[model samples]
Target: MRRTWLATAALALAAALLVAGCSGQPLSEREKGTGVGTLLGAGTGAIIGAAVGHPAAGAAIGGALGAGGGYVVGNSLQNRQAENQQTQGQLQQQQQEIENQRQQIEQMRQQQETE
Candidate 1:
């Protein structure tokens, strides 16, 4: 019984390490959220499944559903972020145009004063 417990602990630790090591690049907020949701869902599912004497099946189903839901939410958030970036770019462009117009007006005024 003690050996079995130790093995389980080791396996869990290894799984965690695997997940942590799989990424070199920092995850975006959306990916982070999805990964968190998936991990949490799988853990919850496993516990519930164990109580019902079918932990493996429970974890599988739970993980799949959780991942799908997480992906959808993450994708939506990413889209919003992209949209915000585009809006910011547009605002900057407009500001530049306004500055150019001001400069042009100043140039015209100076020419008139000289004449």
Candidate 2:
């Protein structure tokens, strides 16, 4: 019983450390998802494994599956965000071009009026 408790605590601490290690930079959606998933999975797995007398194996398997699932979801979100940014950039460029054309037309009109 004590051993199981210690194992669970160690796994939790390790998971926390893994997340803390990534705090040096702003985490993207994918990274955040992966961290969250791994932590949740490990904790849950440990509980379930304790019932079956295999906490470590359960934690390892759960963590791996969680990470993979998190990555997939996070990757999709990242791609969508990138697409949105690209669209916004294109719109801004078009707006700038329009403004430039308007300025040129104004200049042409001013020249004609002076003539």
Candidate 3:
């Protein structure tokens, strides 16, 4: 039983690493979260299932639930990040416009002084 549990754990770790390394490009937050969640959930589920004699089934169910939850959280974070970036862009643009106006006002002042 101890050997079986160790083997299961090893297999889970290997699977997680494989999944994590499958992508060459940088993973999005959602993808990273999903991978992490799957790893954690599967491991936990395997342990629980072993207690009840159904490790594989437990792992599957746990993985699915974890993936869903992780995706939701990651997606929310991604959306917030996008919103913040957009807000920053708008602020920068507004600052630029204000500077342009200041420059124009200075030019007018110079013209008036010249006249």
Candidate 4:
């Protein structure tokens, strides 16, 4: 029983090492996207892979999805930054209008008092 436990522990450690080693490399945007894709794909692939008798292929498909996804994410972030600037401009315009209205009301009140 002890030997069996030791073997299981060793196998678990080895598996951890393999996964860690696979992930230890530096990640570029494309690679990062691909790796995430691979993982996400793998989860889905595991089901499909099991049916197809090839989980690796599933991981590959996921990697493709991830790469595409990452590209989209990068583009989206850029678009959002541009939108933020436009929204900020609009917010400023609204604030200025509010301030102008307040000033106009104050002027009208003063004119009534004088009359």
Candidate 5:
């Protein structure tokens, strides 16, 4: 049983390395996002595959799915960031308007006091 477990662990490690090896190039923003997912998926797949006796196929499918998922997540995060910036800008504008109103109110109060 110990020997079997050791062999399984070794196989999973090798599969993980193989998946890592497959990814080698200049990563774009999308690719970078996908990379983390892919690595995690590959590791998951390796262990699952080893346990179920289909390590290579599982790893391959997992890597592909992970990359696709990661790209989507990255795109979503980027969109959300842009939306936040726009909201911040609008808030700033609103704040400036409020300041102007406060100043006008102060001026009116001063005039009434003098009268």
Candidate 6:
């Protein structure tokens, strides 16, 4: 029974790792975090469940919790990235305005000198 349980757990872990590594494109930060969390959670849960003679249940619970946590973290990171991009855009606009004002001032000074 113990050997069977161990084998099952090992198989589950391998499958999880394979899924995580199979994606061809680079995973977004959130996806990466979620994948990592899910795998870790599943493994940990399996170990605990095996201790209590319920490895499958433990893995399910752990995977759910880990995925939820990863989603939240990923969303937060994405929001931060968006905010940073907005700030940069605002700064660029401000710089352009400043340059335009400088140009106008220069034009006025040249006109005054000519008059």
The candidate maximizing lDDT is 2
lDDT per residue (tens digit) for residues 11-43 in model 3: 876786677677676777787777777767777
Report lDDT per candidate.
Answer: 0.74, 0.79, 0.78, 0.62, 0.73, 0.78
TM-scores, all models, native as reference: 0.72, 0.71, 0.76, 0.45, 0.60, 0.72
What residue runs in model 5 are displaced by over 4 Å at the alpha carbon? Answer: 1-32, 111-115
* TM-score attained by model 2: 0.71
User: Residue 74 of candidate 4: its Cα lDDT?
Assistant: 51
lDDT of 1 by residue, 9-87 (tens): 4477458647766778666757765776676666776778879976765566676677677778888888899999999
Q: Please give me the total number of clashing residue pairs in predicted model 6.
A: 0
Q: Candidate 1: which pairs clash?
A: none
Model 5 C-alpha lDDT per residue in residues 1-115, reported as the tens digit of each score: 5446545654775576567667785444564567777767766776788789877666667767776888898778777877899999999999999999999999999999999
Candidate topping TM-score = 3
lDDT of 6 by residue, 3-115 (tens): 57556765876686577678676666677667767777777887888799888788777877877787778777878988999999999999999999999999999999999
Comparing 1 and 5 on lDDT, the stronger one: 1
Better of 2 and 3 by lDDT: 2
Q: How close is candidate 4 to the true structure, as a TM-score?
A: 0.45
Which residue pairs show collisions in model 4?
none
RMSD of 3: 3.4
Clashes of each: 0, 0, 0, 0, 0, 0
| Candidate 6 residue pairs in backbone clash | none
